[model samples]
Target: MAKHARPGRIDPTWPDLPDGEHPVSELAAATQGSLSPFGDVEFPLDDVPYVHPVTEINR
Candidate 1:
């Protein structure tokens, strides 16, 4: 279900970085002091119901 870019077109999902800016270097700088894991680390999942993909598809 993900949107893909055409053969010669840039993906809109990606950030439009300035010239000479490397993606790896930009990522490193963005998470420079991050010590926590990704996602909803602070959210409580005990009350959330797990829905199977097949079940969701049939809904």
Candidate 2:
């Protein structure tokens, strides 16, 4: 099975989608800008550069 489920349909809210390419910044926004995978807190996108790759890479 695919480790990460690709969105069946791109979300319009994500202007970064549909084009089928996402930059590092756009990927973070798609996750609602979660800083940590721990689920306790979220960091603002502007405040945080990008969600750490290890956390999202396998998601």
Best by lDDT: 1
Give the Å error, residue 7, model 1: 6.7
Writing each residue's lDDT as its tens digit, candidate 1 over 1-59 gives 98885866866677777997765543555355544554435456556667666644564
The residue-by-residue lDDT of candidate 2 on 1-59, one tens digit each, is 65675677666575554576775554656456435655645445347555565644664
Model 2: what TM-score? 0.16
RMSD per prediction, one decimal?
12.5, 18.0
Ten-residue segment with the worst summed lDDT in candidate 1?
33-42
Indicate the TM-score of model 1.
0.24
Per-candidate local distance difference test: 0.60, 0.56
* Residue 49 displacement (Å), model 2: 29
Provide TM-scores for the models.
Answer: 0.24, 0.16
